[model samples]
Target chain A: MKAMQGYCGFLGLLVSALLVGFLAVLFTLVWVVHYREGLGWDGGSQEFNWHPVLTVTGFVFIQGLAIIVYRLPWTWKCSKLLMKFIHAGLNTIALILAIISLVAVFDFHNTKNIPNMYSLHSWIGLIAVIFYTSQLLLGFLTFLLPCTPPALRAFIMPIHVYSGLLIFGTVIAAVLTGVTEKLIFTLKNPAYSTLPPEGIFVNTLGILILVFGAVVFWIVTRPQWKRPTEPNAKLLQPNGSTPEGTDYSITGDFGNVDKSDEDGEAAARKRNLKLDEVGQRSTM
Target chain B: MKAMQGYCGFLGLLVSALLVGFLAVLFTLVWVVHYREGLGWDGGSQEFNWHPVLTVTGFVFIQGLAIIVYRLPWTWKCSKLLMKFIHAGLNTIALILAIISLVAVFDFHNTKNIPNMYSLHSWIGLIAVIFYTSQLLLGFLTFLLPCTPPALRAFIMPIHVYSGLLIFGTVIAAVLTGVTEKLIFTLKNPAYSTLPPEGIFVNTLGILILVFGAVVFWIVTRPQWKRPTEPNAKLLQPNGSTPEGTDYSITGDFGNVDKSDEDGEAAARKRNLKLDEVGQRSTM
Candidate 1:
């Protein structure tokens, strides 16, 4: 019964994440097409509309999904190596869309003779993209490449998870700021303060994005939901036992050193040893 | 040598957090007073200036300090109960400031004949404040009140930490959006997009807030930095050993259950047993 409840809870949250994510994208589309000019690339205001659309769809929603991909129970049956590719592929798609969105805004700005990268939104959004790109490259090298040392992968894993989530959060901040900037600039006729339909719609979209993010964070942080080490993994010795003194308990916020990639076996073993040392020491 | 390095790293991040937090508040003041109107309560825009200043100081800065208070190595020697009070006190102060800031904005809007709670900034900001208030009160009841059961406290502990960080992140989103809104509205003479000095100043302030937040998250999430289970805590039996099958290996993302509060002894024991059961299971 308890297991059933846990399963139900996970399903409910997953559904909520998807529903809110879809609504957020739909709301952005309506806000742009129905309220503002439709999306375009003619060096016009419409070209800039693609920024919010792609940002919500790719940067916020898709990146959020990438963060929690490992937590999905059904995916547990798949080999960790396969899951890593899916994770990386999703993130790559999000990055591509983000780059295109950046081009849209910059292109529109240049054509319209407006200064670029001046607003808090642009500053933050650009930095988040740069950080995301760096994180992606480093993560791929550390977790996916065969030549990287297991010790190094173990060392970088926590930093990788922390930075990934941090970048996701920074993206949310940028999106919120970008939405505010857009509304302020575009809501001249009815004025944003009048509580116009577009204002309420876009505001709802912003809240949905936040809710989606909260759901993703909650899913990924639940220790019970963390991906388990595969039975065939080499973390277990030939005798089918974990190494002596291995501390399985020191799961960080993202949990268990992500035993779902190519280096996961050696990485998990090395990380467990490191965490054991850290856990034993009371000071540092 | 390693311990010294860890300590220095902690200190460096701590100093960075403080520096950025102070600068964020200062920039808000300068942006409001030097660029726009100074603080006031005459039911005017000047009264509204208090909104940004107080939100950054109380909501973002002090509240951030409260979130990472337990991670400070110096504080590990202090009683957990005392730290709880400090945490609650700081959050209470932030709540009070947030209330006053909310009133200022509402009053200014009424006086100016502008509708309230219309923009994405207001929507997200108001929800964040509400969530913060609820989280503060619930945290107090669950973690502070002596009548609460240890089992219950353990169950709620993770949720509390997760929500606290989530609310902190939400406040940041609100602050970023608020800054964008203010710059767009106030930088009309020079135009925000034209890269006015005020615009650049406030944009930098927004980035500072993000950096401060990133630093705080890093400090608290580090497994090496989490407060240790106290020596005399009841989780360690009278014989100075954990109970059989206790599974001390299952430390969660925040580290060992907090061992400083009044309920630390019983709560830690109960929490460990629960985690042991969950950890042994291959699936939730």
Candidate 2:
């Protein structure tokens, strides 16, 4: 188990770094290589460029990073509430970017007199975005809110986790479909069949996106990779002890109460193992 | 939890049925609608039609079914070895079909003097096949072979599970890319942008494929959906006691000995719970 942990620790960081780098390259490929005319909300075909650029940045990259936040070892010492806020914040940014990207696509289509939502990619992409928005809102209400009862939190937690991962997968699928659509639609000189540099880069980007999704999902879902609660974890501040301007938590909801429960369980299990070891030693 | 199980069971069945129906529809779309010229190994464009037809049949549908075989409720009553054989058999068939599909693609490209592995779809699809083949061989060595030590099996099992899911997702992404490529490539008169009936049907098929992939992943990964082990499960036949022509097991490796250890743990826990209940009743 120790060896496995060591392996995952190194591997997870390498993959995460690669994922981020790939996102940057993907952004550059679309924005810098293809749309050198520069981005604007009202420009001609240049406006359409934001659809891929922001979607990759906010939806694919940010959303993926958000999913793996819990598995990040560096963040293990951070407050769970703070981590939750960070997760929600990143997703919120992704959502805002996605919405704007959708606007860009719609605006471009309207300007060009092209049909809207004509492709399978559009249909699934729209669904993914809607699902993501709802997921975020529900997650915020259930997890971040203090008024949420423990029973409700427990009941909804599993579904939230499952839905989050599913939506991430859905988003990646949407991006692949979108990229394919764009490449096939735009490339005509050498044809996509000839495998031009742009086509190759786009294809590599798609593959990297898929790779990033797989790595993120693997890291998030592996049971042994989940962050362990610290035994001496500190309690959150009491009621009316909100962190300065932040109004999210009014009470010590993220306190040591939950941690102590888990810590007690762990301590009991450890004591039982020690007793077993002593018994074995005596017999020997 | 019982309600959750009920929900998952019904949902799994519904999704599985829909997946099969979608695959049939996808086949009908390509073979019946687009390629009414009929399928032949030596025909020109007709041979190209087999690329999509066989891929959807073997790579997508059969592979998916193989992934979820353990989750099927009806299969719980079957012998573990028999289920393993069924799982391996379906995958073997899927692998054969995938190889044949690859041959068809290469053959068509060769006959037309078209370049091979040019598109992003082909690259990802080929990689998926390679990964799937390797995963199958490794799984066979670790699980089916009696020579594999228990420690090795324990170490490899989690990785096998993770890789299986990753490959399934990769294949789905490849399929989406392929469908997008074909729709863009084949439709000329109306063009894919016009969304003709064939284009519409093809897009819907792609969407259905995505839905099927999502459903299969959900069913396969959910802990509650896993088939429960029977408490009184029978042991595999001992050496020279193999059933009929089967010779894989030289010992009762699939026997109930391991299960008894788990059952004993459960019984001890139950006894502790009962003692606490009795003490509480007396105090009350």
Instruction: Give the top-scoring candidate (DockQ).
Output: 1
- Per-residue lDDT tens digits for candidate 1, residues A64-127, read 9998887666666677778889899999999999999999999999998888888889899999
- Local accuracy of candidate 2 as per-residue lDDT tens digits, B1-284: 44444544645565775655467546545643453455777737778778777888888888888877865554555777788888888899989999998998899899998888877788889899999999899878877887876546645665676677778878878887787777767777886678788777777787777777767755554443344433242133232222221211111111111122224323433443344355456658
Per-model RMSD to reference: 10.1, 10.9
Q: Quick one: best lDDT, which candidate? A: 1
Measured over the true interface residues after superposition, the C-alpha RMSD of each candidate is 8.2, 14.7
Fnat values, one per model, are 0.55, 0.27
TM-scores of the models, in the order given: 0.85, 0.78
What is the per-residue lDDT of model 1 for residues B113-135, given as tens digits with 9 covering 90 to 100? 88888888888899999999999
DockQ-based class of model 1 = acceptable
DockQ for candidate 2: 0.17
| Model 2 alpha-carbon miss at residue B88, Å | 1.2
